[model samples]
Target: MKAADFASASPSAIRAMIGRGEWTGPTPGMAKGHVQANLVILPRDWAYDFLVFAQRNPKPCPILDITEPGDSEPSIVAPGADLRIDLPRYRIWRDGELVEEPTEITSHWRDDLVGFLLGCSFSFEGALLEASVPVRHIECGCNVPMYRTDIACRPAGRLSGPMVVSMRPIPASLVTRAVLATGRFPAVHGAPVHIGDPALIGIEDIARPDFGDAVPINEGDVPVFWACGVTPQAALMASRPPFAITHAPGHMFICDPKDSDYAVF
Candidate 1:
């Protein structure tokens, strides 16, 4: 189904389609008002440090829900959903190196693994759209561009790396409105971390992104950056944990709560 088809679909319905292998694309405009979360599964020993990492760097790694050791469901946000297969795609890490991109991780599941549901910026797109701010990637039907920056995250245990950010091209006129709209949902990355120049953030190329496809920025559009949940993947690369699993950039685990459920007011 095209992206519009999912605008009114329930979160569970989207998950079911993903689990059944019907839709495997990036989930930008899907399940309109529901929350979508970034996934991270780590061994019990590594979960603590990651939790700390999230706390220290909440802008890029806000915590949503975390499952108990040996469990696959994120009961707080996505109850009754299987973390192993509900997302469109996942990235497997071994000692910090990305080794596989799979649709489902059933074979890789472990009894000692713990799943964490991190707040995702995708949850705020509905707000942006409602506020009359355009999300270019969604308009172009592609993934939002993401980049790794020189800004360092406060280290937690052995996890340390540059912060990762997702960029959207907001028309010059709507920058403030976009910021104000997204600022209400702090649970899912609230507002633009930087607006205007990309160089100040160490992102050298706006046309080329480290993760996800680049979307066209119109003549009057200004590039906007937000702390991305993909920051953990950078942490994984730097820390080189023995085992880890995360959603592929642009892919997310849909949750049951409304986007308004996370709004501050």
Candidate 2:
């Protein structure tokens, strides 16, 4: 379905599609206006470290919802829903390596696992689009380009790594307006960290991203970067824990909370 379709779709409708295995791709435009989340399922043994990691890296890892050990249902975000089967797709990791992409993880479920729901950039992108600030990636139908930055996140147990940022080249004039619009929603990977000069952030090739597809960079557009929720996934892969699970790239957990629920003055 198109992104416009999601603008009016209820959170439950979106989840139903995912639950039925009808849609298993990225959730960019799905369930619009509702808050979408990043999934991070880990063993109870690693939960404390990951939680501390999220605490230290709030910008990229804002906590929207979290579930207790062995709990498959996210009571706070989606009541009467099972996280393992509610999302369209999931990535399983063993020893930090991506080993499988499964539609459901009923067999993989372990009794000592905890789940975390992180705020995604989709929330802020919705805010930008509403305010008439253009998001080039969406307009071009390409994946929002992301990169690994030289910027380091504060260390927390086994989750320390460089910050990863997603880029959306905005027209020079709309930069400030875009920042102000997104700043109001700090719960979901808020306003940008850098406004121009990719080199300044140690990104040498803006066209070749470390993650996601590259979108066009118009003549008058300036690259704007925001802390990405995927930073933790990258760290988890690097750290090579015994087991971990996360939403596949753009695939996310659609939440019951509306985008306005996170607006701050």
Candidate 3:
């Protein structure tokens, strides 16, 4: 389905398509006003440290909903949704290395596994659009550019790494407005973490991101970065727990919660 088609699709419908393997792509523009989430699954033994990591670093890993050990159903976000088959794509990690990217992970599900659903910036893109702030990646029909930064996350047991950020080139004139618009949704990765020089954040080249696609920056645009949900995946890679699972970058879990449910103001 095209981006426009997904703009009006229901969260349940989107999940169904993903379950059926009919749609396997980035979910930015899908289920427009709903909350979309980043997925992280780890063995029960490793979940505590990750939970502490998310609590300490809420901006990069806002905990939306967490499943009971061995349960794939995300009861809080989407009660009937089966996380293992509901997202378009998933990444499997073994010993800190990405071993596979698959359309579904039912075969990899384990009884000792715990699933985490973290807030995604995609939840606030609607607000940005409503306020007339341009979301460049949606406009360009591409994935938002993401970079690994020099900022260090507080360590929790074995989970620790530099933060990752997603960038959108905003018109210089609307930078503050963009910040205000997104800041209202703290549950999502809200507001700009960095507003200017990419190099200051250890992003050497704006054209080459550590993750996602690169979009063009217009002459009057300024790069605005937000703490990304992908940050935990970076930590997973750095710490290399024996096994883990996460959403493929851009391919997120569409939740039934309205974006307004997460808005603070």
Candidate 4:
């Protein structure tokens, strides 16, 4: 399908494309208006601790919908959507290391696995665009820049690591507008976590991001950072769980809920 085709497609239709391997790329601009989510599947034994960790670290790990152990469908977010094959790509972690990046995980799916869908910033990017705040990565046709920060998350059992942040260079004049626009969607990472000086957050080189592609920061733009959903993947790598699964950076699960459904006001 053409890029425009995917851009205008329905959530279920886009998922169908992913299921059939017709599209295996970042999902930032697809299924506009629908809420997109970050996937993190863990063994049942580890679910409770992860849930608690998410509760304590709401900025990076806003829980959207969780699945029953062994259940592939995210009944609350997208009743009939299957988590195993709906996303374009997935990262499989073993003993805290990413062992494989796969398009489908049905073969690896386990009966003891519980899926957690976290709110994703892509859900609120639409709001930013509507408010006339530029999303540089989207404008440049690249994945949003993400970096590992010095800020540490409160530990929950085996999940503890520095927070990861996604960066967008907003024009200085519209920084407040960008904040208010995204602030309305608390479920999808609410508002800006840090607003200036990448160095302050331990990011020495803004051009070299730890994950995703780096977009150019034009003159008059201020680097704005938001807590990222990928934060859990970093924690998993640190804790080195025997097995885990997550959406590949920039790839996401599209849900039936509208972005407005997650707005606070």
Candidate 5:
């Protein structure tokens, strides 16, 4: 299905589809208007360090909600929801290496695990759309291109790595509009970190993204990058804690909060 089509679907509808195994992929355009989140599941022992890391690096890891150890229900974002079964897909890590892609991690669930929900770009994308700014990847029906950058997030304990960002190619005329619109949503990664020159942010090839699919960049378009929630996943791998889990790329946890709920102004 095209990314834009999912924009109008209710969060529960989208989650139902994901829960039933009907859909499994990136969620850029899905459940538009509702907040989408980055998931970070870690052992209780390591969660404090990760939480502190998020506190120190708010741009990349805006904490939306944190579930008690072994409790999958995300009360604030999606009441009565099971974190392990709600997201369409999940990535399992062991000693920092991605070892498995599981549709459901019920077997992996442990009482000592903590669930973290982080702000996602999708929340701000709604703002961009409202202002008549085009998000190219959605228009092109693909995942937003993401990359690892040389910009280092402040380290907390073992969690440290270069920031990761998602890019949207905007026409020169609309660049400022896009930036200003997104800037209003600080909880969801406000403002452009790098306006152009992917090389400036350490992205070598626009066509070969570190994560997500590459979309077309028109001749007059400039690539705009935003701090992404995925930065934590990159940080997690670098820290290489004994075990961790995260929502698969493009498969975010849909939330009850509207885009306006996270707006800065």
Candidate 6:
């Protein structure tokens, strides 16, 4: 299917494509009005600590849906959806080291694992498009650019790391409109954290992103950064949890809720 078709597809259609291994790329514009999420799975023993970490850092780690230990289905956000295979890609970590990037994790699935679905910035892009704000990556039909920042998240138990952010080059004229459109949905990443120089956030080179593909910053465009759901993977890297799983950067898990479900207005 053409990439443009994803923008109008239903969440289940998107998820079906993912589950069947047909659509395994960045999910930026897929199922346009539905919510997308960041995935973090941990053992039951470490679930509470990560939960605390999410609470301490709501902007980057807003919780959307979490599954009980041993459950692959996230009943609250997408009933009948399988976390083990619904996402386009996953990061598998062992002893805090990234071991593999897999399309499906059914082979690695364990009964004691708990799934945490964090709100993704993609959830707010529909609002931005509706408000006439340009989401460049989507326009270019590529993955959103993401980077790790020097900013530290409050340490909670065994989890702590620098916040990661997704960058969008907004037309300078619509920067406020972009912010205002997103700020209404705190459940997803809300507003911009950094607006100008990437260097301020320790991003030395905007062209070379740590994760996802870099899109062009057109003339008169300003780089805008939003706290990202991938922040937890940064924590997993730092804290070195024995076993953890996360969604690959820019490849999010599509949820059942509409963008309006999380919007303030």
Cα lDDT, all candidates: 0.89, 0.89, 0.90, 0.90, 0.88, 0.88
Query: Residue by residue across 1-265, what tens digits does model 6's lDDT show?
Result: 6555788888888888899999888777678788888899999999999999999999998998889889999999999999999999999998988899999999999999999998877678888988989889978878789998998988999888899999999999999999999999989889888899999989989998888899999999999999987787678668877899999877889899998999888
Which ten-residue region of model 6 has the weakest summed lDDT? Answer: 1-10
How many steric clashes does model 1 contain? Answer: 0
Candidate 1 positional error at 109, Å = 1.8
Off by over 4 Å in 2: 1-7
Against the hidden true structure, what lDDT does model 5 obtain?
A: 0.88
Once fitted onto the true fold, the runs of candidate 6 whose alpha carbons sit more than 4 angstroms away are 13-26
Q: Candidate 2, residues 1-265: lDDT per residue as tens digits?
A: 5655676889898888788888877777777778889999999989888889988888998998788899998998889778888888899999998999998788899999899999998889988998899998878877889999999988888778999999999999999999999999988988898999999989999999999899889999999999998898888788988999988877889999988999997
lDDT of 1 at 95: 90
**Which 10 residues in a row give candidate 4 its minimum summed lDDT?**
1-10
Give lDDT tens digits, candidate 3, residues 1-265: 4755888889998899889999988787788888988899999999999999999998998999999999999999999999999998899999988899999999999999999999988777888988899999988877789999999988899889999999999999999999999999888988878999998989999999888899999999999999998898788778889999999877889999999999899
Ranking by TM-score: 2, 4, 3, 1, 5, 6
Residue 161, model 5: Cα distance from true site in angstroms = 0.8
Q: For candidate 1, lDDT tens digit of each residue in 127-147?
A: 998898888887887777999
Q: What is the TM-score of each candidate against the true structure?
A: 0.90, 0.95, 0.93, 0.93, 0.90, 0.88
Q: Which 10-residue span in candidate 3 carries the lowest summed lDDT? A: 1-10
lDDT of 4: 0.90
What residue pairs are clashing in model 1? Answer: none
Candidate 3: residue 170 lDDT (0-100): 94
What would the per-residue lDDT of candidate 5 be over residues 173-208, giving only the tens digit for each residue?
A: 999999899989878889988999998878889889
- Model 5 spans with C-alpha error above 4 angstroms: 1-9, 13-29
Q: Which stretches of candidate 4 lie over 4 Å from their true place?
A: none
